[model samples]
Target: MTVLDQRALNRATLARQMLLDRADLPVADAVAHLCGLQAQEPQEPYVGLWSRLRAFDPAVLSDLLVRRRLVRTHLMRRTVHLLAADDVLAWRTRHDAMLRQRVLGVYRGEFDGVDLDELAAAAREVLADGEPRTNAEIVSVLAARWPDPDRRALGEIVLALVPTVQAPPRGLWRTTAGVRTVALARWLGSDADPAGPDGDDPPGRALVRRYLAAFGPAASADLRAWCGLAGLPAAVAAVRDELVAFRDARGRTLLDLPGAPRPDPDTPAPIRFLPAFDNAVLGYHDRSRIIDDAHRNLSVAGARFVLVDGRVAATWTVDEGVVVVTPLRAFTRAERTAAAEEGAALASFLSEGENHRVRVAAG
Candidate 1:
């Protein structure tokens, strides 16, 4: 019945995403609250966390990886996400079908006539010994059984077939290492939670709730886009009674947890630096709330952006100890000052305080 204009949604997004003000939550709690950071770029989560959490320590995240409290896994749209180990275990089984389908979408011809269930079992066998293996290594072992299939295709299918974690030294802070994966169970010392016997509630119902918590007042399509799962309509239906819905200006129905934060439309938002693929911009079907439609591609293009007034206003990069900002729109003196302050802090964090130089490029 109520229409949430873009600015209203923008400020709400900023509040829910911890960008409106830096939060002092613990790193583990922050990871859980944000529903996990997009972590395909291993070092990027450190920056992502730095922008949100107050007094964030890079070692705390590294320790999470080493301690198995958090895991770098292929989940949620098949991207490598640094998720809470408990969340991954509870949600991984529900994502299996979507994961398999997505990989097939890209390599369907290559896997024709190959029984996927059989492929899954074989991939599990290869990974059962507890040794971490690269995608190439796993694919090579399976080549004997499916000799004609694309090796890359086979490798990707193996990841989809099994609950796997990209092992440490890869996602560890400031560490550059090749991806080596181990079974999620082995690495976390816990088994995937099995779907219940009743099957009354679907696998993704919890995901819908979690998504709303972090990226809520969103449409069903946005939920699907965020998780890459198509079967959640039933999950949403199962929980429809528990959610409240409103229509956006476009008449798209948005779902929200009744009590979640929806900050005032006029709330002042600070300039914050976001890491590449940060979900605050990508987790919506309609991203106009946080990024202009024209610049939407930047979120997926792996371009780190600067948020000014709760919207993307500049693109940033690092060169020779300098954080360079190229504005998409002319920034006012105050916005430029704010951007500089955040950029300098980001530079120090990126270079471990060895450099804090930031340059705002002429618009």
Candidate 2:
């Protein structure tokens, strides 16, 4: 088997993630292609999309949320993601067990002896009227039934048991609003597609295919880490024969769609600014392809990063119209120039062409 060195994998990741070159794809298609944006931070997706898509309009994403074309919901890894409405509906049922298990993992003692199926039914009843409710509001309705239960625990359980959308204007661009959830069905105006009775041909199988398409040449562990689902060994085995495999330098097997882009290792990579929790860094079990392990925690901790030569080289923040970059390693004069150029572009995008100032902090 061929061995893919870190640089080879890095360039491939950059290409697959659309960071090698900005893509001109539509926002909806880009969201679908990237699986979804990590959107717990509502305004971050616009920056994420701006880095990936050419001529991205923040309003297009905001409009999609308003028009019900895209939705914010707990799905993959039970975290808030902004997903295409159709993708969420089709994929939500597949993720039900994982969502429930994850919430339980965090609050198992609080929910002991509480019949979850009954809890689900009751929560659905509260949401059935089509009025969006805050998590606290929904939990208060069920407080009567579980008076002794922790209210926060009950609220989280209600979210896990019920497939819900964090409805707008929470996810609207530049809008700050508290989360108000409505049933996914009500929000989409259609019911979530029920899983097959036997749970055969499980949704994880499709998830595997999708993951490979977007973030592939990845290992099973990478898939598991990305989705937070534990039962995909069967899904991986079921599809193993269909994928092309390579061994990474670390000796883990990597799987990829046969025709997916695997760019040249020396392909010149431009500096790009990434939003907090952007999956390009978080989607892998082994993130050495795009980020150094020492800096890996920054990805999940919601620190926005700058990519230089297809790897994380600095952390960035904006203050007073200037984008500030603090480098993790010393940069060549050329890399600093490139970082400044991209940072200026990002500043312009963030301020709608008003501010393009950028400062590269001394290493």
Clashing residue pairs for model 1: none
* Native-referenced Cα lDDT, model 2: 0.90
- Per-candidate TM equals 0.97, 0.97
**Where does model 2 exceed 4 Å of error?**
197-199
C-alpha RMSD of each candidate structure in angstroms: 1.3, 1.3
Q: Report the error of model 1 at residue 111, Å.
A: 1.3
**Backbone clash count for every predicted candidate, in the order shown:** 0, 0
lDDT of 1 by residue, 114-202 (tens): 89889988988998988999888898889988998988888888889888998888999888999998998888888898865334655
Q: Which 10 consecutive residues of model 1 have the lowest summed lDDT?
A: 195-204
lDDT of 2 by residue, 1-363 (tens): 999999999888889899999999999999999999999999999998999999999999999999999999998888999998988988888788889888888876888888889999999999998889998889888998888778988888788888999989998977899999899888888988777643365566778899998898899999989988887787788788989999999899999989999998989998989999999998998999899988888988989999999999999999998999999999999999989999999999989999899999997
